[model samples]
Target: MILAFVLLFTASGLQASKAASCLSQQQIREAIDKKQIKHLAAIKAAVRKVVRGDVVRADVCNGNSGLVYELTILSRTGTVTRAIVDARTGSVLSKGF
Candidate 1:
């Protein structure tokens, strides 16, 4: 049981690290150049409609439909929200509070 607990802890840590890993600006630019993703500005604009807040973090990633931008927003109420925008069309795909 102790060994199982240790393995579970290690696995969770690895998953956390992987989720925390995000693409750098240079990598994002490269993806745009290659037509793999859209510009960050467009993604931000798309997300703005769903929530009123400052963007705390933005990440370019792949989704089931294709490339997407995951935006973390801090709202006026001190609440954090997550928004997913389609990189290709600059449309909001989803939002979570």
Candidate 2:
């Protein structure tokens, strides 16, 4: 019985973590309306200043530093760049090639 309980608890925790990581369209709109996050265009511009590339995909997620915009960009040299931008202030937080 104790083993079963532990398994159940672990499953619940994993599910909660997965749910927290996902952002729905409505949640995104609400964040924007509340001024809790910046617009995508602003995030892209901020990222572009640090990394020259065409944005291929992007997502708004809660990171260790609060809300952030994660962008995947394809550079002219055929390299991929990953950039994290502050969702609220539209600043480039980090980048990786």
Candidate 3:
């Protein structure tokens, strides 16, 4: 039983670390600047229009090759909205309504 508990705790820790590895603060900030995202409020507003309802969570997707700002926003309606914006041009590469 003790061994099983240890294994479970270890697995949880690994999972948390794996999620953290997806994105860093510096990368998200850099992506924002590169894309010329001047205001978080504007981004949120636009996202809310498509997502509908409050944003429950937001995260940046890293290691996108040449793409930048892979924004994942979870809406209060339990919808997961994804948008990929150009890092240098502030253009929306792809978005799903």
Candidate 4:
């Protein structure tokens, strides 16, 4: 059911359908400076607002629409979940995609 919910939400947009290539920390900083994507803090905050969990890891990756934040979260129940946030808009795109 959770997976179904995830798919339902992600199906609307935000395709990582292809192999998502992640950037290194240096590249991340460059992207931020170039205004290509939002700061990591903003991206992480966006996900935290939608998902009740601690963001353990966050990475900027190329998505179908544009840049996206790929986050690994540790839920209150100790379950690990992945989420995606739009880099520019800070919108939650996927919860388990």
Candidate 5:
């Protein structure tokens, strides 16, 4: 029983880590730089307005249509904003302040 519990916990941790590793800072920046995912202009504009100590979390979200680029801006003051961009056209799909 103890061995089974340990295995289960280890497997769960590995799965979590695998998902986290899928989106890295460097990879997300590269995606933006290469324009592989859309909404570069809007994302850049939003980033510029972000206050100091703020950071952006980006991911390739798989929605009903397919994969889309989603960026979540987290400000130092705890303000949060979400933006979804088109993967193919780089257009702004949605934005919320």
Candidate 6:
């Protein structure tokens, strides 16, 4: 049980580290203008395939997995969900609150 707790804490730390390196809004806009990342609409559509909610915010991030779009979504009942999708392929990597 202690080992499991340590593992979970370590995993969370790694995820935080990746998120800490995400691009700023200005950089994201530049990437969009240069067509370096997939359109936000496409990224949303991809997340919708596996999750249900309305997107609140989306941003380009360099996650440990790859270049991704991190989105915050609000459900009908007000539950919030966060999703990460591959910026290039629009493939969802993870989704949860």
- lDDT per model, in order? 0.81, 0.86, 0.59, 0.81, 0.63, 0.85
Who is ahead in lDDT, 4 or 5? 4
lDDT of 3 by residue, 63-95 (tens): 355534556666676777777654444456677
Expressed as tens digits, the lDDT of each residue in 11-97 for candidate 2 is 999868856895777888899999999878878877777899899988788888788887889999999988988899998888996
The weakest ten consecutive residues by lDDT in model 5 span 46-55
| Cα misplacement distance, residue 36 of candidate 4 (Å) | 1.5
Candidate with better lDDT, 3 vs 5? 5
TM-score, cand. 2 vs. native: 0.75
> Model 2, stretches more than 4 Å misplaced?
1-20
lDDT of 6: 0.85
Number of backbone-clashing residue pairs for each candidate, in the order shown: 0, 0, 0, 0, 2, 0
Model 4 poorest ten-residue lDDT run: 11-20
In model 6, state the lDDT of residue 51: 86
Stronger candidate by TM-score (1 vs 6):
1
* Sliding window of 10 residues with minimal summed lDDT for model 2: 15-24
Q: Write the per-residue lDDT of candidate 1 for residues 1-97, one digit (tens) a residue.
A: 9999999999999767746655667878898998777788767776777788989988877677877788889988999999888878888888986
Expressed as tens digits, the lDDT of each residue in 1-97 for candidate 6 is: 9999999999999878866888877887788788888888888888888988899988787777667898999999999999989898888888887
Q: Which rank order by TM-score, best down to worst?
A: 2, 4, 1, 6, 5, 3
Which residue pairs come into collision in candidate 1? none
lDDT of 3 at 43: 56
At residue 17, candidate 5 shows an lDDT of: 70
